[model samples]
Target: MTDDSAALWVNGSVARLQGMPDDERLLDTLRWRLGLKGTKEGCRTGDCGACTVLVDGKSTLSCLTLTREVEGGSVTTIDGASDDPELKRVSAAFTAAEALQCGYCTPGFVVALAGLLKERGRSAPVEELMDGLQGNLCRCTGYAAIARAVALAREDAP
Candidate 1:
């Protein structure tokens, strides 16, 4: 490892990174380097949203994002969202709706829903809601519970 270094704000805290490989993905940095494992790596490609995280409060695929791209930017993982009131509501909604089976994809769904709510407001239409969540895939829990969780979160949103 050379003197390559990059710094970014992660989960509201500044992360000073050094000696990172050029090909390292954001997911790898978050999980291995930062020890934030809530962001899962489902597919290495961008097909699966399991590695979703909020970059500057917008939903982004960590697997597809390179570590260097996050330099000077802000990242919010599921662990970070746990401190947010809005996301707390979403998490409660997920629980009430029983939206998770193995819980592998739950963090991605929560991050996506939080991004959607922030972008479209709490009164987003059903069509928009469906579109916003289309990127995520859950094999065991199915989509019904997830949709219900979104609805519940919307209703609970202030």
Candidate 2:
């Protein structure tokens, strides 16, 4: 197969990457090539959500997303989200609520929560919040803290 090259905005910088295989997953490219390790690899499939990232401001499974597909698009990993005020609020809420335990799933949860709040609004109902978070799985911490974190973030969101 022939290798291709693509340019994408990652974090806050534009990255020009080369020698990409057609099937190269976004997670692999981010972690191995771009050196963004915060997006973890869990199930490899889309189910785990451990490799969650924001593509054009939407939460996406990097493991299932092809690198070439994201060409010329914006990709935001946990590293990038860390600097976002909205995501910072979410992170503070997560910390205040003690929402994470093992922390392997924290990045996914954070990205997912950001997407949820962005889509559903800050005052969305509890059921809606729960539904929004269904894509992510956290084995160590029960969802109660996470739910509380969302509520906290809602209270603080503009």
Candidate 3:
């Protein structure tokens, strides 16, 4: 690999990038370059968490993150959720709680919740979990089901 090239672990696999510009957003890299389309682009300004992903086990908004900034870091997206215990647990909770509506924001909510649970542990209170997810928004379901999913995710965190 050339010195200018960069590498990062995506979904537990090494992804080497070549000739990528320094300004390339991580969201674009994940969706277009790597074809991991699970991370959506809701707002490019980072106000929305639609592009949320886990970087080294912490929640990150890919739309606002530059690819070069995450070079050599481990990134986990909804595509990788099934392989991660925390992510899978939260995903299951969302499903069990019927939190999904239009579903565009479901992946962000799931990944963000998993990251928060990982950071704060399963013992973190429901209010704290909800606060951590403040950046994620959904126009459907009135957030009632989502709130239930958050509580359920906390209840079942491993």
Best by TM-score: 3
- The CA lDDT at 100 in model 1 is 95
Give residue 32's error in model 1 in angstroms: 0.4
Clashes of each: 0, 0, 0
lDDT against the true structure, per candidate, is 0.87, 0.85, 0.91
> Which residue pairs in model 1 clash with each other?
none
Worst 10 residues of 1 by lDDT: 1-10
lDDT of 3 at 88: 95
lDDT of 1 at 139: 67
| Cα misplacement distance, residue 32 of candidate 2 (Å) | 0.5
Question: Best candidate per lDDT, number?
Answer: 3
On residues 1-158, what C-alpha lDDT tens digit does candidate 2 reach at each position? 53455788998799888877788899999999999999999999799788998898889999999988888998888888667776778888889999888899999998888877777788888678778889899988568888888888889542
State the lDDT of candidate 3 residue by residue for 18-77, as single tens digits.
888888999999999999999999978888799999999999999989899999999999
**Per-prediction TM-score:** 0.93, 0.93, 0.95
Write down the worst ten-residue block by lDDT for model 2: 1-10
